[model samples]
Target: MKAMKRSTLATLINATLFSAVAGTSFSTLAEEAQAKSNQLEVIQITARKRVENAQEVPVSVSALQGDNLDAYSSAGMDIRFMNAKIPSLSVESSFGRTFPRFYVRGLGNTDFDLNASQPVSLVVDEVVQENPILKGFPVFDIARIEVLRGPQGTLFGRNTPAGLVKFDSVKPSQEFDGYAAVSYGSNSSIDFEGAAGTGLTDKISTRVSVLVQDKPDYIDVKAPGFEKEDSLGGYNEMAARVQFLYEGDDFTGLLNYHVRDLDGRPIAFRANLIEKGSNNINPLYDNDVVYHDAASRSTQEVDTQGLSLKLEWDLKEHTITSISGWESAEIYSRADVDGGYGNDFAPTMGPGFIPFSSETADAIPEHDQYTQELRLSSNFTGDFNYQVGLFLFEEDLTIESYSFDTGTYDEAAGNYGLQNGYAVQEQETSAWALFGSFDYSVSEQLDVTLGLRYSDDEKDFYAKRTDNPTPWNGSPDFLEGRANPSDSHVSWDLSATYKLTDDVNLFGRLANGFRAPSVQGRILFGDVVTVAESETTNSIEFGVKSDVLDGQGRVNATVFYFQMDDQQLTAVGGGSNFNRLINADKTTGYGFELDTEWVLTDELNATFNLSYNKTELEDDTLAVAVCAQCTVTDPTYTIQGPNGPEARAILDGNSLPHAPEWISNATLRYTKELEGGEFFVYTDLSYRSEIDFFLYESIEFKGEALFEAGVRAGYAWNSGDNDYEVSAFVRNLFDEQVVIGGVDFNNNTGMLNEERFVGAEFKVKFF
Candidate 1:
């Protein structure tokens, strides 16, 4: 009954929103309401390493600007907010907000290790962030954001089977400009972001930006004999960026340096809250703000520093560009993995549970990354254009993880002589690629784009056990080994665009992409070593970009299909929570995306986007681990399997985890001119269809449709040459409880979404 209600509610809300937008569009068309408030701005992107109108780029991409960009950052500076606003994108993280895993069109990796490789690529200012920790870098300052869908192999090279999220920060200019924003919200949360830029000389200009956030904990512990000192959900994080630009008669150089410091609590896992094979929260466990813990707090600390330089020189009819980047970080996080104390783990028993509480910690004290790229492109206006580039990347990382028993408990729960089980892993990776592309105009109305890249990657891995804490563990020196793996692949893409009219175009694209091989060696008390071969994907897509209703509306749509061979997947192994990397035979995905922006009136505007994708494993002999709390409903649920009792389920037709069948986001904004300023009201709604958290299809491991809404209202005015605005906003207005990920090894542990936020914001601009 609850599932029915939730589904019905989502359908109704979506239907209502769809009808309203359609009706408004039709009504405006009938009345000829093309009063031209603010025409949709032309979005320019660098998807092809050159500036071009997004509509003419022959790619399926979305660009957010102005108020939309501001609203997204205001909701949350993390990349997860991009998932909520953009269609065909989803993000999940087991290691809190610092390590986010992204999925696009149902293509992504489920590995949570620091060195895990992902098909989806994240690029900030043309620099790729290879590590999961670096992907969590905060989004700040001005400029635009672009989400490119489908396989971006030709330009991005390896690990781009899914696509890319590209961020372009505002640059310095000769004219001075700056802005500041501050907000205070519920749970004693505070957010502040500001940037200032100015020209120092005829050849030099600089800009500085900063972001800060503080929030108090909101969870209360109800365990017996445990006093809740303060909230466990609080956080204090700060990030800053400095950019310098030097412009010459024939050359230009831009340098950027950034740093982030964070102190907060990671995601909390709730125990035994999810029912078997379903998204339904067990009614018997109705508490939402209560948690049990043996420790005072689950704490985390992270520090990151990065520097990048871009240089370009004009060489007659062509331009030469070079980019060099380096980044380093250290992170430490500890959490209550069990979600409860002794009563929950070994109920009806005394202090016998050795851990007293199941606590896990991960630390990465050594991490470094370097990248260099050199490219040359045509600068002349002609029927043909070309670009060629060479790229090199290197990384060094070390991680230490521990699952320990609290000292307060006795030996009944099986505590060995050691204090905890610990593993140390070290990895070094190097990659190089050569890529080139050509764009030719077959005629006045037709264009063709061809691109190709050859990439080679190698990784050196070392892992060993530092401690053994389990009762059954006899080898204190559990595992110590090294692996050196190398992979080489060829990626290519072909596309053609035909101009149907001055205001419309049609395009089709075919692309192939690949990800490097992976190694998993986080073994202390369990299995030895596990490794997965490289994976590759081929995709075909068709799309249309148009400006309709006499410049009053714009629409973009695409349909795509992809097949992945030798897909890398994660599986649970042996005792002591060891994870193994394996390769599945094949998987396929098909989807469609629709995006529309309409000017309803001179003072009102509306934008709607929807994406639907379906994915399934094509390998029939593949068996996967079932949900920890699943109640076997499939008639073929057999216990006889080669991968132990826990891994006895077949996943042949299962949809990919974290891939929702449907995702939609809509926004409406209205502006009114006042005597002294402009007043505006904005609201947005986002919805996602049912999703599974793991490969196997089980009732308790899936969630039904989820919906979230936000609203902001503000007034803006100008004083001389300065601008100012004040606004009040509310995010997740209804406080929807959504489950994003699951921990199936240790009971039915799950992670929940953030709570509601209500706040008032103030901003000022000066030039």
Candidate 2:
């Protein structure tokens, strides 16, 4: 039985990391160790938005304070557990929890076509979340999370040619702290989170946080008399924030407000590829079907709201700042594709099958977004710095799908009417930017930094087709009219740092980036309306940061090289379903990253992260015309003669779908501060080496090397100054069922992979 359930999940993750280090030495020696030297203070931030010392931020960033998010919530902290401990992050999703796809280094955009546009860009505090369903927004009370990488377009603007992910919360602080946690383990898992604040006077203060999680589905919903069998998916979150601060005199004002709501029901797994074997197939499968129903039951809802304002002045030489923001989001979803019998063979020979009694349902298509930004920054005496920005965005998307035909018998047009007419799109964007950066200190071990940015972009789109209830008129099915394009760009960056001593430092960077050209709703259902150009990149980097030993240990390394032009690839076009966002002709990528942390004593601590990526297609006639059309064609028919040009010449030179050319992540953490509150053990490993889910790579997907290890044990309580802690956690451990994502697009005729899950977790904190 799966090796006795993987030896009972590796003995419950080493007995929950040795009972959370023996309940932290029996609650910090029964509360009397003088709060362990004030919890060994030394956590600082600013991640370059100003304020320094996140290790002197000269770029290459990564921070995850807030008690390391409570020890990664017992080893499961979204974004695929921080992309397995961060090393060039990567995330993939195909409509599960409402689309998620992120990548850095190898860039990103798997083009699941929901209006494709994502080159790594997501900011929270400085607000900028160009709707990708808010990038799966979920992470609470975070006081930091940087991950800057490269090409931040001179300072984050435009689609950020591959870099940027910032989220900072936990503001309003005048004293009164906050913390609250709840957790339950094993299958019926549950988790609750909380936060609070005080200081409602002395210039106002407020903080609120909330998170809720539920677990139950892992597959097996046999219908009939439904009696459960792992039905997979669950998550919910609610948030709120408010703050106001003033310290007049030379002026300093701050105001903020935020709200968020998220609901999720995730579970989508499919893989039976006609019983495995097709060049060693194992897209994850555990089957038992009589008629057919692969499985997928989804629900996602998101609501976000924001407002921010800040102003500061302290002309003691020169200092000024201003930032303003507005944000909005709304999303709704529904998905139910119990594949079994292909939903009864798409109402007998597709072309718009609509059947599936029990009142068919497949919603999913309602999105709205709005954004605004304004910024002004300056700092004169201390080596010049400047910023200027303005941006606006809007979106309105819609999708309405209906299916039915539960085996014959209709009573007056009732089996189904709207097979699929698809329409509803609106996009508008505006931008303006001007940035500056300068730092020069020739002595004291050389220092040089220079930056610049200039951007101007505009886009407009519109589509319509409220409903067309079957009649087959073809041609002019949608997209009445609308398109306005405009673009202008300029990006730059330069850096040089040398301090080979002082614990080491040697940096180098040369950058340039750009991205602008997006119009949603599949250009109003094809027929050439393609306008989506502007993609450029040029980067070269070198880095090294050290603190080896004297500071207990720390190491960082980076190496990069990128060259792209006109590159805006998105394939899948051989008459299967339609999608093609072209512009490839030159491409190249090189990478290497290494991270280290070691305190290997004083109770021991260790950490390591690694990344290696290689991308190509440096022109070979645009990689054989992007691998000859790269499979995907069926925009309502069009194929005749010579097998339609040999299926577009089998999309020549293919390879670029979910671009994964050996990606790696590693983690090894250990902490033992027993005496009352501390004892942690961790292991997170990730490896991805097979990719090409389509884009003419004609179905060739493979995946493996996935591991998750965990352990946590805690207990703490300090009376005299009030503080509390409690813990217990267990995750995956060894319930390894692997396969985090899958695709068989052309092969197996479509859709495949995703399944296997195991759970257990518990946490508590009060301070």
Q: Which residue pairs of candidate 1 clash?
A: 276-700, 277-698, 277-699, 277-700, 277-701, 278-699, 278-700
TM-score of each: 0.92, 0.32
Error of 2 at 600 (Å): 2.3
Which model scores highest in TM-score? Answer: 1
> For residues 1-767, could you state the per-residue lDDT of candidate 1 as single tens digits?
01223653564345434433443464357357535646777888988778899988788888877888898777345667776578798777887779988888988877777778888998988899888888898888858888888889899889998998888999988789999889999877889999999999989999999999987776766555554745477779999999999999999999999999999987776766676545677553332354555446478899998999999999989999999999998999888766655544454322112223467788899999999999999976889989999999999999988776654444664532224678899999999999999999999999999999999999999998867655444555566868898999999999999987777778999999888999888775454677889999999988778776667777777778788999988864212356778888998887677888988888999999988787888777887555444553332444643344444567777778789989899999999999799999999999988887766666766766779998999999999989999999998889887777776665666777767778999999999
lDDT of 2 by residue, 199-306 (tens): 677765666666665555544655343225655455555656666766556777777777767676543434333323332333333432212232333455667667
> What TM-score does model 1 achieve against the real structure?
0.92
- Best-matching candidate per lDDT: 1
| Superposed model 1: Cα runs more than 4 Å off | 1-37, 75-77, 276-278, 282-288, 343-357, 407-418, 473-476, 572-576, 632-647
lDDT of 2 at 94: 63
Q: Quote the lDDT for 505 in model 1.
A: 79
